[model samples]
Target: MFDPDEIRGMLISAAQQRMALTYSEVLHALGHRFTRPLMRQLCKVLDAIDEDGRAAGEPGLAVLVVRQSDGLPGQGWFVARSGSHADLPLDWEGTEARRYVEARQGEAFDYWATR
Candidate 1:
């Protein structure tokens, strides 16, 4: 089974490195689908991470964990018809979206930290 925690960790690592990965990879890692609410929540998480100044290295993993609790898009991971830059096969998809999430992931803390 795909573990969200593990996926979050990878994103966090990518954030710390300030490197970006494919959005499809992120979805694959989480075993999720591309849905509207999921996309919104993911965006919200990124916004929250930035607002909280957790968009930097190493510490943003907490944000990922918290945001992850919002849940995956669906049962299986999402598929992108074209490149990662394509519409996410959903709307609101962007080239930087994946990187943005990664940056936030690195600053995440324990789930309790969010509460």
Candidate 2:
């Protein structure tokens, strides 16, 4: 079983290594410490934080992140339109997106890093 402290430590370490961690990355960092449902909830909270840029406000988009067995966070970046207009295609290159995901995931755990 994963202790809360252990999970916290892992998150901190990941955050420092990657710079920031995405919502899904946070859950993935938790590893076996939390169940899938619990991770989902965490992801929701993380998204809320991301969207609001604060601790409150409705999410601008709904994204699903699948957990990988290798302990790395798998990202599926999906953006939804806030209005009736169609969603814009992501222009970020694959490598850049991957880097962004890793950095965000890193932020999820770094205690020293300010959100």
lDDT for each of the candidates? 0.41, 0.42
Model 2 spans with C-alpha error above 4 angstroms: 1-32, 54-96, 99-115
lDDT of 1 by residue, 1-115 (tens): 3444455556556555544454444655566775556654554454444334433322433233222423232211223212432333352234444444444343343322443
Candidate 1 lDDT trough over 10 residues, lowest sum: 73-82
Lowest summed lDDT across 10 adjacent residues in model 2 is found at: 57-66
- Residue 67 lDDT in candidate 2: 41
lDDT score at residue 79, model 1, on the 0-100 scale: 32
